[model samples]
Target: MENVTLSEIKRTPELLKQVESVPFKLEKGKRYLFVGCGSSYNLGYIAAEMLNKNGYEADVVTGGKIVALGDFPEADVAFFISRTGESTETVLAAKALKKRGIYTISIVCAKDAELSKTCEENIELPFADEESVVMTGSFSTILYMILRGIKRYSIDGIEGFLGKSFEYVDRLELKKFSHFVFLGFDELYGLAKESALKVQEMALQWVEFHEPLDYRHGPKATLTEKTLVVMYSKDTAYEVELAKELKQMGAGVVYIGKEGDIEIPYQDGFETPVRILPVQYLAYKKAVSLGLNPDKPKNLTKSVKL
Candidate 1:
């Protein structure tokens, strides 16, 4: 029932400094492909969005999609992200890209893993590796590394944020909520998606993710006392109002903004990774409350070999 995921989450700020000096070279003016599964795929989605928005050309695709349907974007280089580096689809996808003369790079938490061995080059962050079936700190660490490599972001003061998020979660009773919904826009939308996955993976909770205003369209029909809607606000007036409105409607709301529940300073999109910390803590706490083991979720493995 014990695992390194919790320890790794607590060590995020220290982990960031360890990889800060790594010579990661993401060439500009070239098309790049980012591929992975689950949290890894979501990180790729965020990275690709950030890179494309900041003077680079990048595309994101899932390893399963590439393996099952052979649908992948053409690119000069492919970066395969896998925490365990042994996911069958990711390793197979790397092999497929390398066969096409595309430069392949593996970003993994462990060295000499199948995906790393299959790719032409690799960047391994063994310090970020996890012992749990679910991803926590490794998700943020690899994401920070990718964003830093692309020269789109640099992070600071996250150590304080890490402590604050843990404290916030410690004070709350997470068992009250039976369902979780996360909302954001653009890069935050990617984060919203990741947040939903975190609860679903670590807590086995019902979860949904959507764009901010879109929830009012049809998703609001499901609002109830058992639901907790988390708004990763851009600090816009409309987003702020929506959080207030949701709270009034009986659904518990967690508004994360410059001055909200979690009190995160919005820095363009750089805060996106850190914005996930509270939700990660929330999920873990919720799992513990439900008498479930966050480290070993049912019906899941550390790596999806098939």
Candidate 2:
């Protein structure tokens, strides 16, 4: 019996290919703000980092921050991201941003979502929608769509990449590991956070995410033989050393970089959508090893509605 989460993960490359032809555009010299919750928030965070790195001004704020603290950044345009487009805080934040006279755009995987209705413009990717509670393919699809808005890309060789990544994950002795840690920086940091969320959501496992160097500051105290560290590296010398250090501490390490256990060359954050796929597969495999169903995570719904 295959899980819906696995099915969705398997379909991601096709989804990316389909969305490549879809046009989404962004204007230059305009400050952009992104709003969302949970996985959606992580998506926005990565978008902001990439955009800023590319000379565009962008910032991301969690929908909860806007709804709870009444905090809003000044921007000519704001993008509200929600997979189902019904997340309560996101809708509320979109409404608030619209009220303040900023143009709002809804990037969602659902058709005619409430968040879409509230925004001045909507970028809907219904084709990327998923049935499972945990986000799999849709997350990558939406992120790819947004990245395409800035720079055109063809996800060439994605099939081979997926095949290799899944095969690598399959070879892991997943049951021996209880704690999972993901490390990265900047746009990769957003990916690291989302990777932790994937394992925590799908496998109900202990997980953590941190910037590569910051892990040594205070977090490495808990490292043990049962810990597995997934490093999303920028090919930095310091990060390379840290991987060796973590390994010496008896923690199993999966370094992801130009030369890594799972080699994924960083491409100025353009490769993020693809970079996330292996970790998604790892989480699904871990859930299966623990006799949990990744298709239906505990205490979660497809969308978080108020």
Candidate 3:
């Protein structure tokens, strides 16, 4: 019900600091695991990608799957992402990992949540608590924090990328799209997934996500003049070809990133921190236009009880 833009805007610095403070030394051959539920699960996906991109071996799994599988690699560290820090499956997975003597970390909005209390480290997000049933700003802010945090610690040229991304968000007319699709490859897979989730949670739209090469598959059958396809151009040769194909399908296509003919100035290299902004803006603007409070999506609370 309140303005979330300010909070989302202010979160970058704090996120950078939180990421810097974490002790990252890992034993040789040890793995890293990221776990969460729902939007938090999406965060885990992003975190895992960031970690992998930074030369760490990391994998993402839903908290429920972690509990059911009962077997994980001997992780040197595990991260649990929960906005409220109290997701049932995340808490249980954290507890299970702790019992194995692994270092557990929590990225959460609630500083004093049970998950935070149980983990060895807690990174509290700057986004305000969401009162709606669906997650909007909370999901984006936390993910932005995670990406920014990774950029601060591992990647170079992140701040410039973040600034450019913010500027790009200011320019987008996000609510104009009636239907959406996100396409990407490699690490961009996480970005596309998060982008699709943002539309779904904040705007209540089921945005489709696909691998760039796979778009030619059966899924392309749904393409129409009304469809908006947002593709991440990760400096790949296939991007231009894929964009061309999608355009031929009679869908409006917006290509993101550098190294593409349809250049999006806000996107930079594959590692640029600003890459997340367009989708974030898309979610925010769509929420504003729909008269639905992005700060609170319907049927969504800060946390799931179980």
Those runs of model 3 whose alpha carbons end farther than 4 Å from true positions after fitting are 5-28, 68-74, 121-176, 259-273
Clashing pairs in model 2, backbone N/Cα/C closer than 3 A:
none
Instruction: Give the distance in Å from residue 17's predicted Cα in candidate 2 to where it truly belongs.
Output: 0.4
Best by lDDT: 2
- Order of models, best TM-score first: 2, 1, 3
By TM-score, the best candidate is: 2
Span of 10 residues, lowest total lDDT, candidate 1: 1-10
Across 122-146, the per-residue lDDT of candidate 1 in tens digits comes to 8999988888888888888888887
Decide which is better by lDDT, 1 or 3.
Answer: 1
Q: Residues 1-306, candidate 3, lDDT per residue (tens digit)?
A: 346653563354445444545444433355888888876776667666766766668888888887889776667778888877878889999999999998998877766899998899887763445444455446645555555544443444555655665566556555556788988775577678778877777778768988988988788887887788888877566877888888887887777766432344433332423465556667767777888777677777667776
- If both were scored by TM-score, which would come out higher, candidate 2 or candidate 3? 2
Taking the candidates one at a time, how many backbone clashes does each contain? 0, 0, 6
Query: TM-score for all predictions?
Result: 0.96, 0.98, 0.79
Please report, as a residue range, the 10-residue window in candidate 3 with the lowest summed lDDT.
261-270
Model with the higher TM-score, candidate 1 or 2: 2
